[model samples]
Target: MGQSSSTMSSPVIIPAAARHTATLIFLHGLGDTGHGWASAMAAIRPPYVKVICPTAESMSVTLNAGFVMPSWFDLISLDPNGPEDRAGIEKATNFVHGLIEEELKNGIEASRIAVGGFSQGGGLAIHAALQYPKSLAGIIGLSCWLPLHKDFPKEAKGNLTTRLFQAHGSADPVVPFHWGAETSALLKQFMENSEFKTYPGLSHSSGEQEMEDVKKFLQEVLPDN
Candidate 1:
């Protein structure tokens, strides 16, 4: 897979091998760089689909005892009902939107793009995709839960009919398995195309089966034309 870094914070881009018809913008988890998911995504994506893996900015995470690390937003607490960094989330969401806008400028329709991520990144993807003003091809989330879930269906004005694939391990410790199930349920309240899968013995990290599922989801949603 070809790789290039145009700027200090630029994403690790895997250009489409053939005519670019679709784009997948995948975000990395906390403390990880875009390079972490680059090769994996490239292996699964079709030649006509360009993969863009964007790294999160470095910031101090309260959950990590104020240690600086690459994170999409500040994790003030792990409590599902605890305080959230709304400002930080908004900033990151705007950044994701900017990436989508750039692809649109490059002639890729909003419907030809998919946004997804893992863990913290996955939460951000769900939040950003739901708030996006245009319809996206799909949304993928792995081992993730919605960050500010209270404002849903109402705040989620766009992509109501868009397809969503969310997966979580039954033994996930970081983000409880129930959170994923609840998120799927909440999303289903308005999004009829949502699907949630459970991994029997999986943990906080992804497995071979999960990746295969993601590959199929990508193929189904962003098929080559």
Candidate 2:
């Protein structure tokens, strides 16, 4: 598989308001590209802090019968205890970490950059934030799971200061409610104010009301204008 780059082509959404104090790094789900979730960015709001949606290196997913797809990892199932490609997950984590590093090198401070995603993207966000060296503006995951079932890194308890806003659709047939419950509980076991919202009757995709919730969460997590 091709290794990830410090910079990748992304579909970006720039807020017309003044220069943003922070940049939001948006990662897409399995089988989806950077541009796939550009739809969600629309409801995100005005004076847009810069939003960067990056595409993953294309690869085969055994779960998808070896079909090459843009993904953070090959997810075998939404079950928290299901099979996973640990190596693939680690590589993806490194790639995401590299993206964050590149952004910092380009002038966005660690505290001013927020990393987030949907489904598999959400899983990766949790993975990198826990492993990150410093606190970030925030982390968001919509209909996602934890990357692995392993114990949280000991350093994670102390290093993680990033505020988490996790939202899951109660009707999400892919990822079950239990997964979101456990993930949220796990976060609370580690950090202060790791927030979780279960959208009643919502399905795999976010609806307008839920999307508005995301906007509110982002605005709350981001620094004041």
Top model number, TM-score: 1
lDDT of each: 0.90, 0.76
Could you give candidate 2's per-residue lDDT for residues 1-225 as a string of tens digits?
355554345555544356766778878888788778765774484454677787887777777788977777776764567788888888888877887887788777888778888988888888878877767888888888788746574546333656888899899887787788888888788777688998889877777877787788778877565
TM per model? 0.95, 0.88
* Pairs with backbone N, CA or C atoms under 3 Å apart (clashes), candidate 1: none
What's model 2's lDDT at 152?
76
Lowest summed lDDT across 10 adjacent residues in model 2 is found at 7-16
- Which consecutive 10 residues in model 1 have the weakest lDDT in total? 1-10
Off by over 4 Å in 2: 1-17, 45-48, 77-79, 153-159
Cα lDDT of model 1 by residue, 38-130, tens digit:
999999988899999998777778999999888888899878889999988887888899999999999999999999999999999999998
